[model samples]
Target: MGRSSLLKRIFALNVAAFVLAGLVLAFTPATVSAEIARLEAAVLVLVLAATAAIDFLLLRRALAPLRRLSGLMETVEPLHPGQRLPEEDSSPEEIRRLAVAFNGMLARLEEERRRSVERSLGAQEAERLRVAQELHDGIGQSLTALMLQIDRAARRVPQENPLQGELCGAREAARTLLGEVREVATRLRPEALDDLGLANALEALCARVGDQSGIPVRLSVDPGLPPLSPEAELVVFRIAQEALSNTLRHADASAAELTLAVGDDGTVTLRAADDGRGLGDSVPGAGIQGMHERALLLGGTCQLRTLPAGGTEVALRLRTAEVVA
Candidate 1:
């Protein structure tokens, strides 16, 4: 009940107490006035106790809907979306309105979130493509031309000339730089990702990392795996790329494994695990943060944990609907 109604009820009780006191005084003689006063006070105490009990129950009942709404909100998951509180005719009118409004807000937020993630991913991919092009066409070609000139100049110099050795060193360094430039370009945006598909692209990635780091990287992909949409494929590739990079750079790992599995229901799972020192009480860096964000954009989860056998594992699962038939 409202505050005004509660106040009126308390006023009525006080009036009743006064009427009871007057009646007791009228029925009793003056000699028993003290006893009559004590009786009236006892009745007032009983009335107050009853009122307090009733008020407590009323307040609890009024707030029950809020408690239920809180429980429903706790159950909502961002990855799955579309969760809402029940808004039925039987529910309290105020609570019903609240649920309806909250659900509408949630719907708008989910749509906006999806659009934002798509835009971010699109922009990221565009930037990667641009960088890869610049590295390959700009710096790579210049280095190649410089190396050719150095080779010709070295050939013109006398074999016995002391400067010839320095020329040879410069030529060697240029060739090495050109190879590294090409490698960086490939890593930024692998052409095989578009030409050979996700599985082959991943295999190439693992091989290259292993070769460079002198660490063994084993890759396994389910045969006849269905293709994914370009965006989804890129997300998966980037996660693997970051995970392997972390392992190579910081894991102190001698060997690593990459696994890709596609379920019958079109769920895709990618896992990268290594036999090396685990996270070891270290904080997550940008690589881990980026992987988690990319997975979240696809309505997926990324889990990182220390392996039971002693290492770190990065596991990701995406429930994508774009599986090829």
Candidate 2:
């Protein structure tokens, strides 16, 4: 036989209770005549009211767990997982089973979301690598050849010739353009991360940001940190980059600090703080949301908050054990 549903159980309980009450009344000496006395009528009304109050209390108690679960569902955020309903021993079987099923569903959804983000970000990184290579190998080489030709032509011209000045200027412009292209390529795909490792890459990033933005940036990397997968490393770097970029663009800050450290339990943390006007009532923009999404892909968390004293802080935490690798 199929298991009884909550509604059916409730209906059965109410029907049995009413039938027992009727049997007790029929077996008792109490009788209802065509015209009843005022005291008897009052007593009947009180009995009916008492029975209704008991039924209401029983129904509320049975549905309380479901109501609590509904409230949790309403408040749960899709981007930030981990919310779950409590499955208490005292709860009805139906409610407990529902809680278990809902929790399982949340886990599956979170895993699917993580996978989707991984594929999307992986594709993005691949594209960046391709574009960076093209800029460095193709246009960059052409610019280099152009600069050489300009230099040779300027050398051939007489020192006093007006055209020599134009050639020199042209060469200088080409050199500047080449430098810019290289910088863009570096930004698109950081070679230092592949060559020098995460620590050095972060140090170079801080230096470059400070040079470009005219803001001092300090970096500290813990010694002998635990190893992180390439994806995890990239996520951390990107979050740091976005945090610094936001500070440079909107914080109006003069200085910033970036730190990488491993916790006692082997959790890796990346934090960036800026000494600037804090975000006050401003909603998180795309960059901030991107940082959060990147963290989620690594099964990590990214938190952005304004410091009490001044400025803003972006903190990213990843558990080494939970990382998907």
Candidate 3:
């Protein structure tokens, strides 16, 4: 037979207790006169109080598990999944079924969220690639040609002509514009990642960030690390990029370090640390959340923590199989 509902169980137990009390009173020889003595009134009040205490105890025992479940539900975090209520055999049947149903619902929600994040990040990466390619191939090439034309014109102009200086200046301006365009393109999508592989790309990224931000960014990579798929590499690079960006903008640090290594259990780990003022009470901003989402997309974990001694660290761990696959 299906288990009874919680309300029905509670109501039946309470009614049975009350009925038993009534039967006991009916069978007892003691009788209360219409004008009762003080002793009789006192005894009646004590009986009612005892009955109320018993009822209260029974109600608390029956609803304790539900209260616990409600507290846990309040603490559930969407991004961090896998929390579930205990489904012990000793628990009430109603509570056990409710726990199972709630756990299943959480599992489904997490799966749906994972798929949504996958689609959103996938589209974002595709758009970045497209824009980077256009900048490099279309506008980039046009600027190159323009610079060449300007240089040729400068060469043909007589050295004594005042107009020759203007041509040189124009050529220099075109060159600078071309450099800026390439920089922007690289930022959108690093070509080094596609051509040189993760290790070199990461090293180049650190060097570039250090140069631009005036902070010393040290890098360490394990030479024996296994190869990673392009998507995994992109995720790692993006997380590192964001972490370093945060360090530069908010950390107020003088130096930073980025390390990539493979664990003995074949997990890939990336860590970025800076010796700066730690994140005190500040909440994580969009950049930090993006890092977390990227890691989740790759079936990895990302953590941001403040060091005991000083500064902040962003650590990411990914199963090697997930990255390689």
Candidate 4:
């Protein structure tokens, strides 16, 4: 027979041994014609029953944990760090060991996940800091000096007729640089975010973007929405910031809309839509990925897609466990 069949036969033999032990007690000299036979038969029957019971119990004690453990492994959800192997009070050493192994595996996986998240956030922060430094040092300082030079040149515009056009272009360029510096710094962290409330900060941001990009941005906020925690506020603001930036960068949109609202049922929603060129087949950058990760960390869902007419829209929902700061 095949190996599986052989094992099955062995299992059958073990069961038969237990049955034979019982049969030996029931049909011995105890159950025959002698007057003493009835009493002996009763006693033997009891002994055989006990022997059968002991064998089954011992086998069960040895194999029960393994059987349950097999089922546990199959049911295990490895993706969820919160999930774990079963812990039983009276399981055998082998079973306990299996559970221990599973728990250890989950613990290690969870630690790795935490480190990965931290590393990602750290990278984003570093980028922000880098961009901030770039703007402040390279762009901001240069724009300041250029503005001074433009002012000096403009004063001489009365005398230098030929230099008027050149001065106008220089002045425009200086202003553009100054605006670009502010935009870069805004992307890293808003000036008002730390000092002012979230609502005011968002309003200021939307207005500034609209003015700079030459795209009319409309913000609609529902009065019912409660004040969010700093962390949640920061997340929402950043997502909106990226979405608007994308519209300005890729959509070539003439107009964009932003909305923040909360329902009585405790639902919070953020939406940003634009009427620009729709999404094309292109890989998302680290900025987009960072926003997605931020939403995910808050147990929120983020959706970015091309609208039917044209342009892209972003929608997001935050979970209750999310802390603002």
lDDT of 3 by residue, 106-211 (tens): 8898888888988998998899999999999999999999999988888888999999989988988989999999988998898899999988999889998999
- List lDDT for all candidates, in order: 0.82, 0.86, 0.87, 0.75
Ranked by TM-score from best down, the candidates are 2, 3, 1, 4
TM-score of 1: 0.79
TM-scores of all candidate predictions against the true structure = 0.79, 0.90, 0.89, 0.59
Query: Can you list the residue pairs that collide in candidate 2?
Result: none
Worst 10 residues of 3 by lDDT: 23-32
lDDT of 4 by residue, 1-325 (tens): 2222323444665777677775775776445455657677677678777776766776675566578788877886533345678766455555666788888887787667656865777687678878887887888988899888888978877855878778888888889879878777866877677778677787987898898888889998887677788768878888988888888888989999999987565668889999998777767887677777767656577778889898888988875546433
Model 4: residues with Cα > 4 Å off, grouped in runs? 1-104, 153-160, 204-218, 222-229, 244-257, 263-268, 272-288, 299-315
Across 1-325, the per-residue lDDT of candidate 1 in tens digits comes to 3223333444565565566555645665423444567766666566556656655565666567768887898888776566788876566566677789989998999889878877987898899899999999999999999999999999999999999999999999999999998898899898889999899999999999999999999999988567788878888899999999999888899999999997787778899999999998999887887787788777788999999999899998888574342
Clash list (residue pairs), candidate 4: 229-324, 230-324, 230-325, 231-324, 231-325, 232-324
Flag regions of model 1 displaced more than 4 Å: 1-38, 71-90, 158-163, 323-325
Q: Which residue pairs in model 1 clash with each other? A: none
Choose 1 or 2, whichever is better by TM-score: 2
TM-score of 3: 0.89
Model 2 poorest ten-residue lDDT run: 1-10
Stretches of model 3 off by over 4 angstroms after superposition:
1-12, 32-46
Model 2 alpha-carbon drift over 4 Å, by segment = 1-12, 27-29, 33-46, 323-325
Best-to-worst ranking by lDDT: 3, 2, 1, 4
Number of the top TM-score candidate: 2
